[model samples]
Target: MIGVVSNSRHASDYSQGVRAMADFARKCLDNWVLTVNGSFEQHQKMIRATLAKRAYELFELRGREHGLHLEDWVIAEQELVHHNLNGNSSGFCILVDCPRDPGIITILSVTSRSLLVFQSRAMADHNPELIAVHLLPENIHPEQTAVDAVDGVLQVHLPKQRNKRRK
Candidate 1:
């Protein structure tokens, strides 16, 4: 995470810490550098470690402001897909990710309830690879697996659904 860097120890410099960290993370993603060879498994392992490191780096960079941990925030993959709630042919693309594979970023179909919903770690905890709510009409329950990315740390499985709603 690289953003606004401070030259001296001033109180205001401390305040821009968030922006600085955001810049840093963006740069890391944009200019991510990795070198490895061998089996696909080996390559994925390296990517997984890299993703985890970036997540922790983000947490550390922002520690000066919110005092948060790596797990405290939601680490959604940057990809987005279109979502349809009203059964419209065309859908709106929103930034969201499956809890299971946070790295294989994609959009989702959320009802009005989750329209503007941004997830926290509490929400993504063990979320299934939400490959579109619009499942195939005749598909059976398939097995779980890690995301196909540089990192393979994507958690698989949806959160347990409860009959009770949040109060």
Candidate 2:
């Protein structure tokens, strides 16, 4: 009877594991469908909502100042854009998992002007910093490039430079 009980318990555990795996698979499929079906208009609406929320938070953080609403909105929009560029689900720090070794780096994006955003953890055990350096092209406008660190992830945006046609 002991052998029978052991087999039954093992089968129960196996079934529970299979159910968990199925649930995870279903969630992944749902997320993929949402991502694929999400329209540009929908994305823009979401961005606008995020900007509004961030602007409100900024106002609250500043002790609810009466004026500077436009300034707050602009800053909040920029902040939200930067946060989204970091590929974070929310405007929060994303913990990057890496093997316990130095010199491991991941390049997130690179522009035509060679401007790039790469992720590399500090080599030192103490005071580890997530380093992201943007190399700007000499002809590129400085204002066009924005660098921000969010949730240990570095985001660098480099707008394409427009070529001037001379007659």
Candidate 3:
């Protein structure tokens, strides 16, 4: 994946590393999921693998009901060993296996985090009398949002698809 940034005064190598991590995430999600404990390096690794896996899979699971083989995707994991205060040096690091939405992904493997997210989304989406967009969770900043303190299949509505009901 390509890296996007608008700051030259930031850690350029680190930003590049972030993209590299995203690329890795796009490739080896499962492994990254298993790793990535909480350390910055671990988080970067998981991010890369998650990005790699999701972008690669696009969440399609039709062929595997009867048992289809999954592909071993590999992202070009380049090293970012530079750190400059004024450059914002950036790159990708990867753990490969862990994901925020493991339930949908766990069709290929079984993981607790993925399962929880998948189930949470599925329930929110399936619940009727509720707007669809609200069903999908959002990454609120500062640990806050309009739906603060909401739980049990949250009903969030996206502005673009108002009144639309998701499956």
CA RMSD per model (angstroms):
18.5, 17.4, 19.7
Task: Return the TM-score for each candidate structure.
Answer: 0.21, 0.32, 0.19
Q: Find the 10 residues in a row with the least total lDDT in model 1.
A: 29-38
Local error of candidate 3 at 119, Å?
A: 7.3
For each candidate, what is the lDDT?
Answer: 0.26, 0.35, 0.23
Q: Between 1 and 3, whose lDDT is larger? A: 1
- Candidate 3, residue 107: lDDT: 11
Error of 1 at 80 (Å): 13
Count the clashes in each prediction: 12, 1, 58
Off by over 4 Å in 1: 1-38, 64-167
Arrange candidates, best TM-score first: 2, 1, 3
Best-fitting candidate, scored by lDDT: 2
Ranking by lDDT: 2, 1, 3
lDDT of 2: 0.35
Consecutive 10-residue window with the lowest summed lDDT within model 3:
127-136
The parts of candidate 2 lying over 4 Å away from their true place are 1-34, 83-167
